[model samples]
Target: MKSALSAIVLLSLAAPAAAQTPSDWRTPDPENILVVETNKGRIIVEMEPNVAPAHVERYRTLARKGFYDGLEFFRVIEGFMDQTGDPQNNGTGGSDLPDLEAEFPFRRGASVPFVEAAKLPADNAVPQATEVGFVGVVPVRSAPSMQMMISVDGKAPAWGLFCQGVMGAARSNNPNSANSQFFFMRGPYASLDGQYTAWGRVISGQDVVVAIKTGEPVAPPRDVMKSVKVLADIPAAQRPKIQVMDTRGPAFKALIDKARGADGRVDPCAIEIPAKIG
Candidate 1:
């Protein structure tokens, strides 16, 4: 009986380990990553090739061609985000490339779906849960354009969370106005969803984003991108190598489980592992 009980304990301990799934984690294509250098500091972002292949490719082409070398962060909203990517530095500049069809419905997880609302939701009416077996929305084939932004807040139903250092595409008053000008999420703000197109997320240098000075009473806040360069432009031998956590892996699931309780509220740190980069 003692030996049987010991075997059961051993099996229990091994259950989670056995269930752990190894993922084919690959580095972002050098062409698909951007290194945005701001006066505050630098941010490293990985474009979602799976979600917006055309935009990602176009951005890579533009960056490699020196299109974003000296742009400024023209719009800085305090406690929100810093917007930039205007080649003209006048809040309205873009590449010679024609406007591309919007790509919507990129899957991050079970939380959100990317797409435009053909019809607005009814007042006080919550949409039904999305049906299972839904793959994600895809973009129409058309011309390619380059623009992006970053998020710094919680997740949205139709948009990426405004997490620190996230990158997204800049747009005009119209939803399709995003051309080349973009923004970076400086802080948490959920209201911008459906108002902007989220195209990428920063993988590093979030501390630089936190340190940016907030916009003040007198002038438009400034957290300018000193330079935006594609990793391909840098010599292979000199580029920084980073490994991102696989969001779909068992480790990530364990992390999410540990961060929140049965009720969804995050537990105090005393009972949880420090949620810092491992």
Candidate 2:
């Protein structure tokens, strides 16, 4: 009896750590994953509707209709991102769906609006008129649309930080022009913020993204999106389970706090330790 009890205790101690590994990882909802096949390679992006529901829904809608298949990367800048999702395969194509309205307000130093009802209303509330800066208002009747641009340089706008492997929609010069073309950030770049509508990020297979070859120099260069498919189209149990670190959770705050000491001094070596430990 004592030996059996000891075995149970040992199992209890080992269970959680075993579950934390990949074997116990939960697969993302099929509806949430996008399989983008590029000429260079395939990129699987996990959509964060929690972050940008309108934009994510639009992308899913387009993907279901087979709108992104056969599209070319169209634009590739080394150390930057590989851009695709153009139905025209020329960096200028969209779905049959009409353009969507811009969701986040274009402002400096502001966050991407939260999705909760209380948060949404508060975000939509008019900022003090005096606080308005370079406002570009579109007619209220327009559909909510977004574009994709991968960061290649420093951080650009305040909407979202351009990290490695972000997925976004593409658009023309018009704020409402994003229809089908999208891009992935290969690296970090800040200059693209206000100019692009960021919708999602890559949750896995980032190595595939980094391996894509660049296109030739031309008026409108071309990389390739070999194909694009929704995860639902694939059989269940074959998909990989990816768990994102909860940015809003205490774990994240603790990480950030440790990055910049209480005095707000950043020690680069401190940041490296976590990656090494992981």
TM-score of predicted structure 1: 0.65
lDDT of each: 0.48, 0.47
All-Cα superposition RMSD per candidate: 14.8, 15.6
**Candidate 1 local lDDT, 38-66, one digit each (tens):** 78777777776655556677677777777
Model 1, C-alpha of 47: deviation from truth (Å): 0.8
lDDT (0-100) at residue 90 of candidate 1? 56
Query: What TM-score does candidate 2 reach?
Result: 0.62
In the range 60-128, model 2's lDDT, one tens digit per residue, is: 888887777666655666767766665555555567778766544332222332211011111233331
Question: TM-score for each prediction?
Answer: 0.65, 0.62
Candidate 1: stretches off by over 4 Å: 1-26, 106-126, 130-159, 213-223, 264-278
